[model samples]
Target: MTSIGIVGSQGRMGVALAAAAAEAGHGHCGVDKDGDVGALAKEANVLVDFSSPAALEQTLDACVAQGRPIVIGTTGLEERHHYLIDDAAADIAVLQTGNTSLGVTLLAHLVREAAARLDPAFDIEIVEMHHRMKVDAPSGTALLLGQAAAEGRGIDLGDCSERGRDGVTGARGHGKIGFASLRGGTVAGDHDVIFAGPEEILTLSHRAENRMIFARGAVRAALWLLHQKPGRYTMPQVLGLGEA
Candidate 1:
């Protein structure tokens, strides 16, 4: 049995991960805000980190020190954090992602493919809705989708994306990807990618009914990371998309 440890045990995702681990017949340790992650790291084969961005660097440092693979689902990471993940991958397996839903991951790929095939004259927009407790706007998932769309067009996301437009926004520009965010109670997660043209509109969406979908994907990623050589990996690798 693979031993597992979860950071941010008190949060919604944490609780769900812990339960999912238990249901999978894996032993799990939960670490809260004041808990000692290093101590737990010593006992687990793999670590799942769903903690805040503020604590991410330190948490990853502890895991790296022990040479333990980790699956990170923390969002709002800066460029420096990406550098750290790349550096850590040189020593231990590290799989970091903004969203852990397998469907969403697949959706990102499809959105990229659609964006590549569709005409540039078609306007692309990504919209996501989540529970109100979420702190980030446009969501990390939405940004991931936008990034896929930008990458499909061979353009930088920062240069072509517009997020959180309000009031009398001017007419949408060509080749510019747009994002919209909505927050409410208990909504698990929902994302839609829309391609609008003068004659037709195409929409692709993924709706999460429960947090378990993400928890399951994270657990799968952690398990896969434990067997991989030290390097950066994503859900596609875990799901065998890399082989395809």
Candidate 2:
């Protein structure tokens, strides 16, 4: 059994990670903010981080120091954070994802395939909803789906993504990827990608009833990381869902 380390031991996802580890028959140690991440890294065979962006630096450093693989499940990361992860990945295996649910991973795959086959007239719009406590808009899963759609359409997501439409906004642009975010009471998570074309509408969706799915997928990813060479990885790679 793997000895897992949790970097955000006090948060909701942290508690879920602990339970998932136990269910997977893995020994686990945890550390919250200002805790000794270095010590936890030393104790664990691998690490799972579901903390804020601010905590990422220390966690990656400690993992690199201890030569331990890490699964980063944190959200709301900026471009700088990815640069940090890429640097650390050169020294130790690292898996980073917006969402770790296996189902979401597959959904991204399908979105890509559909986007590739559908006509450009099929305007793609993505919608996501999460608990009221969630801070980020559009959700990371929505961005992931947007990225997948962009890839299939042979375009850059940053250039094509349309978010936060308000009054006086004109008609939706062709080939633009629209996003809508909803926040309410304790929604685990919900996502839908709609492809609107002439006389037809196609929607692909996924709903998360509980956080355990994320926890379980992350545990599986953590296990997969143990044997990977020092490098960056994605959820699709962990599950062999990437196109060959």
Pairs of residues at least 3 apart in sequence or in different chains that clash in candidate 2: none
**Candidate 1 runs further than 4 Å off:** none
Q: Assess every candidate by TM-score.
A: 0.96, 0.98
Give the C-alpha lDDT of model 1.
0.88
Measured by lDDT, the strongest candidate is 2
Model 1 error, position 142 (Å):
0.6
Candidate 1 lDDT over residue span 10-34, tens digit each = 8999999998888888888879898
- In model 1, the clashing pairs are none
lDDT of 2 at 77: 96
lDDT of 2 by residue, 77-115 (tens): 999999999999999999999999999999999999999
